[model samples]
Target: MSTLHLQQLPLPDAEVYFIPHFIPAPESDVYFGRLVQEVNWQQESIKLFGRQLPMPRLTAWYGDKSYTYSGLENKPQPWLPVLQELREKVEQASGQKYNSVLLNLYRTGQDSMGWHADDELELGQQPSIASLSFGGERRFAFKHRTRKDLKPAPLILSHGSLLLMQGPTQHHWLHHVPKTARAVQPRINLTFRYVRG
Candidate 1:
């Protein structure tokens, strides 16, 4: 946390900060390997247009409360030591308490997340989310929900990077990780948040 140089992204109607090297490369490598092996990653299926299809990536949920996302309820799983350690580091940098984390494993460049906002009711109003990225770099972008004049903001989430989105960001903007055809290494992303019981 002491090494973080948090920089606020210059975007209207949102509170977003990015730290490219929240953790050093050596530490990140160790954490990344631990996460890939320790966390119980699962390939889930989503309902789309009345058909059940496998999600593009693997996912895992852990922490204090159950979460419902993408029309599915994810029951909480016991936190692993690695997760707890990472959580503490992230909490220090973000200066916010988080009781839960949602992890995604993009096994290939084709795995991706669609456009969406983290404005769930359980998150309450103006929720703060601390996103931690590991492994391969990926392109991330945000777009205003109803503004035509504003251009979409794009960013590259590098290994060991941290992205914090809070305040009116979820209400005003939607973000996504688009699929790429280019070959790339696997990636893992963790989004830490507090879920009100």
Candidate 2:
């Protein structure tokens, strides 16, 4: 059995849990190296206001289904053995079956993700997302969709950490990784999801 202990984050109207050491340091280092060398990382782009701008980070999609996000339709590549291994661990911990994973490589502190919720219809209602982080620690935050009265919760996503978000979390919250001015090592993040037909 997995020895992972999940700690629930303090936030209303959302179910978020964090595991700071889902993967041990030595194992995380190996996985990080393998992913950076083996995965076909691509510099994807987004069209905003009809202007095509390259995304801040390199990404890859792997699994059994096609998914669309940020106006980009991603045709998934077959899962790598490394990815399949990781997915199994995530599934065992979260008690959710995931057929797809979206990976992001932040080459520097400047590479970031904007505020968005994983509410895509293909993911079905009450989607369970298991996010795994390997490499440098980064700041992650979640803000309420409408309740300005509540403060945004910020967190440090450390290496080998796993974050699980489920239930009504996406329905009421938006999250993002903000760019920082500090110098930091590269970070790889994988969000595992279950896509419905």
Candidate 3:
């Protein structure tokens, strides 16, 4: 286990904590390999503009209850052992208990998430989301919700890193992993959240 260090990122109207190397390299490798094989990764399609289209990345949901987003309802898959283990670590680090997690697998540089906030009604008014990254490094950017003058700040989400977003972060900012042209390896991201019943 590595010494936990929280690095605060300066963003307007948001509270974010970046922890580089949250999991050691050896442990990260094990988790990454197991997750790739154990997780039920699926490329789900969503209804957009009255047309169905595949999501850019593969995703899986695991938790105590179902979650709905982007007009799609995600039935909870029972948590795997490895996921449960990681969840405990994340909860300890962030000091927040999460009952659900949304896992995203970016198979290549072309796979990405669009700009959006995790502000669904099920997440309550303010939610604390703990995102853990493994495998390849990717660019994570944040744009101010109402401020057009503010430039988007890009952060490098390296393997074995953990980012904790809390407070008014989701309410005032939109974040995403943009598509890239450069060659990149697969990456897995797990975002732990506490969904309201």
lDDT tens readout by residue for model 3, 1-197: 22478888999899999998899999999999999999999999998899999999999999998999999999999999999999999998988899999999999999999999999999988899999999999999999999999999899999999999999999999999999999988999999999998
Least accurate stretch of 10 residues (summed lDDT) in model 2?
1-10
In each prediction, how many residue pairs overlap at the backbone (N, C-alpha, C within less than 3 A)?
A: 0, 0, 0
User: Residue 90 deviation, candidate 3, in Å?
Assistant: 0.2
1-197: candidate 1 lDDT, tens digit per residue? 34469999998999999999998999999999999999999999999999999999999999999999989999999999999999999999988999999999999999999999999999989999999999999999999999999998999999999999989999999999999998888999999999997
Residue pairs with backbone atoms closer than 3 Å in model 3 (clashes): none
lDDT of each: 0.95, 0.95, 0.95
Tens-digit lDDT string for candidate 2 (29-112): 999999999999999999989999999999999999999999999999999999999998999898889999999999999999
Worst 10 residues of 1 by lDDT: 1-10
Q: Give model 1's clash tally.
A: 0
Please state every model's RMSD to the true fold in angstroms: 1.1, 1.1, 1.7
- Models 1 onward score TM values of 0.98, 0.98, 0.97
| Count of clashes in candidate 3 | 0
Q: In angstroms, how far off is 91's CA in candidate 2?
A: 0.6
**Candidate 2 error regions (>4 Å):** 1-3
Badly placed stretches (over 4 Å) of model 3 are: 1-3
